[model samples]
Target: MRSLPLATAALTAAAVFVPSLPAYAAPAVQITKVYYDSPGKDLRSNTSLNGEYVTIYNATTRAIDLEGWTVKDKTGYTYTIEGVILGAKKKLTIRSGQGSDGTSTVYWGRRAYVWNNDEDVAYVRNARGKLIDSCGYDSTRYDYKNC
Candidate 1:
């Protein structure tokens, strides 16, 4: 019988490649920790433009709706993150405040002082594009106890 049609075509190609694989889940936003602040605390400022800040930590467990979620700065300058809401483990501070014409308001470090103040690369996207978290550093790499 031709090996029963090659074992029914190898079980229909392993059930269509095992459900198309790649279904890990678990990663709503787990950056643990990351740092680069200079608003004034003096945590050994390496310099990230002035009043720079980018701290995100939500080691999962639930609660995460950072609106559209976006923060880029290699020069492209994205920074969307509206409304905000990151409970779970908790910890979110994407800065560049002082708006209202007082100056110092571009959002998400506003390019962190034009780059190279050490280095920069913090992209966290999740509207659908994926990439729930990313953390590249500079300006002495500030802090990241559990990243």
Candidate 2:
């Protein structure tokens, strides 16, 4: 009977403290900004398309390997991240048009724009397709949203 009471106390203590331990409870990365509408005319040029981009920020203190991760819009237009390691507390801009990939920038290589000008949602997923973070905007008055 004494052993049973002691075991119950230990289990109760574990349950009470386990969830309060210091841990990373939020996503390491998030969509920080989105430039849905490019400046000037919507001429559909590569440079113009590149002007419209989404910027993601790493919120962790450690570098995160983003290979095979994905960023998708509401209509299923997705960009699979490849060979990019996000540094701690940094931002990466994913461009819509074709370009060389750099440490802080990547190109989606899409000929057409992906995000809707009226309203849309951007979902970031991990390599295993688990949702990490999401941001949405519904405004034609502004060309960008600080998500």
Candidate 3:
């Protein structure tokens, strides 16, 4: 029987191992932009519900169901979004008032509760406790800031 050459054996081994490379996985979600309609020195003191809002942009290619996701305030209370499915590359706006048309514009059912025009953080997480995106803002400065 003829013995295989060293180079030929190495090539065969490499071919077998290369195909087992890990597959690419898609990210859950991400915050592409953040903004508020109201531009005041004290966001915490803002009373007009319509003036304060938070906009989240979906940066993934797949549609994400935001039913269980939440937007936490500085006080650790979460504002849960119901019946919301943000499409790929689409934007969802959460204001201090009622719900929006779910297109480019979105409304917040309870805006006043989450409106804290100071330094606040927005955390986006899935149902499985996985954090998707996070953004912080200083209400004293930009009314809106992109994450």
Candidate 4:
């Protein structure tokens, strides 16, 4: 009988042990809230739409750069987050319509309403196109899903 080579024997042993070890997944930074429909006398106006927003929370210990990230509605409206750093355990809110960006809130700069008052979905994706989170809502019957 021929003896197994040193590299072959070591690789076989390593493979057997490695497969049993659990792989670690990265901690999830989640979408904590979505104020998709802003209540007011007027829903079509920019001011009313501006009140519509989505909030993301960083549940990790380190600061995260959200630049190039996108928050988009089921419709064509998409808000690109730029030059924003979410601190550890911090929350960032992205609102619809035009406004100056601030520490806790940012604007999407759309003149019209992005979220449908009756039903809509919001999606968040990182720079690498990885889906960070998503939420859906149906305001007519007050049904909110995947929040």
What are the lDDT scores of the predictions, listed in order?
0.58, 0.91, 0.66, 0.80
TM-score of each: 0.29, 0.80, 0.62, 0.75
Whole-model alpha-carbon lDDT for candidate 2? 0.91
* Runs in model 2 lying further than 4 Å from the true structure: 1-25, 140-144
Tens-place lDDT per residue, model 4, 20-136, is 668865446677777766777654677887787788888889999998988888875788889999999998988887788998999888787777778888888998879887778
Better of 1 and 3 by TM-score: 3
**Candidate 2 collision pairs:** none
Give the C-alpha miss distance for residue 75 in model 3, angstroms.
1.1
- Can you tell me which runs of candidate 3 are displaced by over 4 Å? 1-28, 36-47, 99-101, 111-113, 139-144
TM-score of predicted model 3?
A: 0.62
Candidate ranking under TM-score, highest first, comes to 2, 4, 3, 1
**Positional deviation of 52 in candidate 3, in angstroms?**
1.3
Comparing candidate 1 with candidate 4, which one achieves the higher TM-score? 4
Candidate 1 lDDT trough over 10 residues, lowest sum:
97-106
- The number of the candidate with the highest TM-score is 2
What tens-digit string does per-residue lDDT give for candidate 1 at 1-147? 999999999999988886566878756675543344454544433343445656666677787877787766566666677666777887775555333221212244343343234666666777775787766765564543234
